[model samples]
Target chain A: MTREGWTRLGLVAAGIAALEALCRTKVIKPLTLVPPSRMVHDLAGLLIAGDIFDDIGQTAIEVGGAFFLAIVLGVLMGAAIQATPRLRRAVAPVLASWYAVPSFVFYPLLVALFGLSTSPLIAIGVLSATPAMVVATIGGLDRVPRVLLRAARIHRLTAAQTLWLITLPSALPSLFTGLKLSFAYAFIGVIAGEFILSGGGIGYGIAYAYESFETPKMYALMLLVLIVAVGVNGALHAWEGRLLQRRQR
Target chain B: MTRLFDSLAIVAGILLLWTGVFEYAGDSAITGPLQTFRFAANLLGRADFWQHAQATLSAFGYALAISAVAGIALGLILGLHRFSGDVAEPMLASLYTIPKVTLYPLMLLVFGLGVSAKVAFGVIHGMIPVILFTLSAVKNIPQVLLRTAKALHLTPMQTATHLLAPAVLPEIISGLRIGFALTFLGVLIGEMFASQRGLGFLIINGINSHDVKRTTAVILIVITASVAANGALLALDRRAHH
Candidate 1:
């Protein structure tokens, strides 16, 4: 690891230690925040007990469904728009400002349309996640070198061949960015939908625990979410790093 | 002229789609665009609606102000110190990608159920982008410009105003645009989960009560307001960039 990496790890360790000390000293009430160690211990016990597996599975399905759909739809739509200049011009402003409107505001409307099921949650996830992928796809396509296309034409490469061999490779970085954002947005949308309105999921579990005054349980579930989010993001970051390194070679 | 025509066409397309959905789904599930617009107009005339709007707007305003000030200051400091920026950038980026909605319970516990919790939520969602943009903007400033300022024996304040501010303004505006959206989202989510007031609460309340018209209408108003604000900011962003 670099000096910056070491320093970051040290800083995080120090922060955790400080919080642990504060909790132990009773400066921070257990009601407000349990020690980090207690949260982890509770999380392990909860996992072993396996009561929360259903909620985890539900959330995972919703997020995965949304992520898959977003990538497919976003890439197809982005390509279609890119191929048509007039369509691109018409939608550019809308796409640019899309994130400004909280799409979750439409969650209730979705529930009304689809009923109180995973469908609404997945729909909301797709609504939030798809735009990021679409935007990234457009951006990626925009950055693909014009000379590469000209060379492909000169070589008489078919459209499919050119896309597979040249366009897709060139656009991989931006598309990876899109994939990362889509996953994050889908996860956030699903979890938040559950938190706000759904009957079940890890988010609902936390909210339920909060309302029932299960403070330790709530913190444990929260710790699970934190671990999952950081772990997935770290894995993706590392994978992207490796991919880029291989590409450079 | 073409741009105006395109904008009108897009609006028409969206309305058509809305009407089509309404036709397919029936009045039980959703209202048509015209019905929603009329309902929104009526809702806007009501004083009670403004109260909810005020609650959301004020919380959002406080959050945006705090995010801008604190994020810019921190970003500037980090950017000026090369080592600190390198160490902090990845940490900040990771934080940005996390599903912060999970932390809502924690915020509610700490700040309780009020405007403060909402504002804090908004700040957390909004501030990271600003810090990132400003930090990168400062880093991207030419070394020659700093050297020239130094050669002229300019004070820190003068150097900041004359050199740094103008250079970073464009990127900062871009960041603010994103921050504006996310902050609005954060506040709404905060309201939806715990609060008794705000547009978010109204929507959830309408859903719980099965008032489809009210829910749809409130959503329309919120979307219109957000899109209008973002459009204005986007115009400002383009001007800054050019």
Candidate 2:
């Protein structure tokens, strides 16, 4: 690891240690926060007891469905827009300002349309996630080298062959960024939807715990979310780095 | 110009889509675009509606102010220090990706159920983007410029005001635009979950009470306001970049 990495780790450790000390000394108050160690311990107990497995499974399915749909739809939409110059010109400003609107405001409308099932959660997830993928797709497509297209034409390649061999490979990095963003947005959307309105999932569990004054359980759930999010992001970052390195070579 | 016509066309397309959705989904799910606009206009006319809007606006204002000032200050420090910036950047990025909704309970507990909690939530959401943008902007400043400043023996304040501030203005504006949206989002989410006032609360309350028209109208108003604000900022951003 790099020196900066080590420094960051040290800083994190020191911060956690400080929190633990404060909790142990009764300065932070047990009602407000538990020690990090206790939170981890409680999380392990919950996992061993299989108490949250159903919630985890439900969240996973919703997130997976949303992520899959967003990627497929976003890529299609992006490609379609790219193909039509007039449509792209009209749609560009809308897409640019899309995120400015708080999309969560539409969750109730979705719930009313789809009923209070995982469908609303998944729909919201797709709504939030798809735009990132679409933006990335457009960016990637825009950056594809004209020289590569020229080479493909000189080789008498079919249109599909040019797209497959030249366009796709050239656009892979940006598409991967889209994938990462889509996952993050999907995860956030589904969890937030569940948190605000739904009757099930990890988000609901945390809200329940909080409302019932189960501080330890709430913290445990929070810790689980943090770990999963950070772990997935780190994996993607490492994979992207390797992929880019190989491309450079 | 063609651009104005294209924009008008897009608006027409959106209204058509909304009408189509209303026709398919029926009255229970959504309002017709025309009805929604009429309802929204009525809402704008009501003094009580402005109270909720004011509540939201005030919280948003505080959050944006705190986020911009703190983010720029912290970003400047980190950007000037290469190792610290390297250490902090990834951590901040990871935090950005995480589901921060999970921390709402903690914010509520710490700040209690009020505007302070809302402001705190907004700051957390909005500040990071500003910090990241400002950091990169500062880091990307020409080394020659810094060397030139050093050669001239300009005071620190003079160097910052005359050199660093102008150089980073465009990127900072871009960041502020993003921060504005996010802080607005954060404030609304905060209202939706805990508060008794604000347009977010009104939307949620309307849904709970089965007032679909009110909910739809409020959403339409909020979306229109945010998009218009973003459009204005975007224009400024483009001008700054040029």
Candidate 3:
């Protein structure tokens, strides 16, 4: 095994051992904090029962819907701005400043508009994710060599043809980055919305467990969230890598 | 000057579109731009808005300060050591992927509700980026630069101050920018979920009471404050990089 793999395994093992000892000695209250072993056991039970699937499905749908909205709106906005250099230059400062605004602030507005439904969650995700997508789209396009466009002009290619054949492909990496960012941000927004709005999601599950003092269940759910996030991100990254390689060829 | 005009024109265009939308929606509760501006102006004059704004900003400040110190220190340690970096970087990256919001209940369990809990949440939100940025900065330091510093028989402290610090400042600033936004979001979310005070609480209170004007006013104030703060930070970062 690679050194990094061994190091990670050793650290995880040590962490688990420490937690077990802490729980066994009653140094930490097991009621408030479940041991790692118990957490794994509870997670297995929940997976076997499969009741959490509903919440997982709801959250996934919200995130996916939001990401879809962001991609459509953000790409259009990005394309519009890029097509007009003047507008892009004018909006750059505004976008940069907007980046600092905590996206959750928009949730109240969404809830006000959409009420206590999954729509608000999805809206929150879209609102937060769009900026990243727009920025990435612009950046990706900007990185496309000017010489290539000149070559396209030399070849007597129409603007539409040149854009379809060259610009989009060249900007694929940055576009993918924007998509990745949108997905992650959308997921966070949806989860936070669920926590606040009592929407059905893993976030709501965590909150529910906490309120009822189901410490082990809460831990299990948090672990599940971690796994899902890691799994999705890993999958997306691998997909991005393959796309980039294909573009190179 | 033309660029300024272009920006003004765009803003005007957006405002016109926004007004049209507001008019079309025809919701008496959701005010148009003029009313929103007037109401937001009134909110700015109110002591309550200022108090809530102070609460939010103070929490943000406290968390940012704590995280900056701890993140830089720990980042330096981990970055300088191959063994630690190999062990901890993956863990840190994974932790970053998990929404810090998920850990709020845990934070509340440990710190209880109020400013401390919010600050703790904010620190966790902010610190990871700083650590990751700093670690990468340290890892990316040119070997030639280190060799030059060594040949000069520079002290460790000197090396840190003169060589390492300047080399990493740009990345650190970028990290700080991300950290500030995340910390602000963390504090805002924390306050929204469980606090009795702050801008978030005000917004929630406004929402619960169905006071659209108040909620809109608070949102406006927050966005303005956040944008203004971000602009200042961007200015600072630009100056440092230059």
Tell me the native contact fraction for each prediction. 0.73, 0.78, 0.49
Give the candidate number with the greatest DockQ: 2
- For B108-140, candidate 2 gives per-residue lDDT tens digits of 878999899889989998999999999999899
Query: Could you tally the backbone clashes for each prediction?
Result: 0, 0, 0
Task: Write the residue-wise lDDT of candidate 3 on A118-213 in tens digits.
Answer: 898999888888998999988988888899999999999998999888898899889987887787788888888887666589899998988888
Docking quality of model 2: it rates as: medium
After TM-score superposition, what is the CA distance of residue A211 in candidate 2 from its true location, in Å? 2.2
Worst 10 residues of 2 chain B by lDDT: B92-101
Q: List the residue pairs that clash in candidate 1.
A: none
lDDT, candidate 2, A1-249, per-residue tens: 989989999999999999999999999988888999999999999999999999999999999999999999999999898878888989999888988988888887788778899999999999999999998999899889999999999999999999998999899899988988898889999999998889899999999998898989999999998898888888988899898898889
Q: Which stretches in model 1 have alpha-carbon errors above 4 Å?
A: none
Candidate 1 residue-wise lDDT, A70-93, digit = tens:
999999999998888998999999
Assess candidate 2 and give its TM-score to the true structure: 0.96
Two-chain complex of model 2, DockQ on C-alpha atoms against the true structure: 0.77
| Residue A24's lDDT in candidate 1 | 96
Per-model DockQ against the true two-chain complex = 0.72, 0.77, 0.51
What DockQ class does candidate 1 belong to?
Answer: medium
Per-model TM-score of chain B: 0.97, 0.98, 0.92
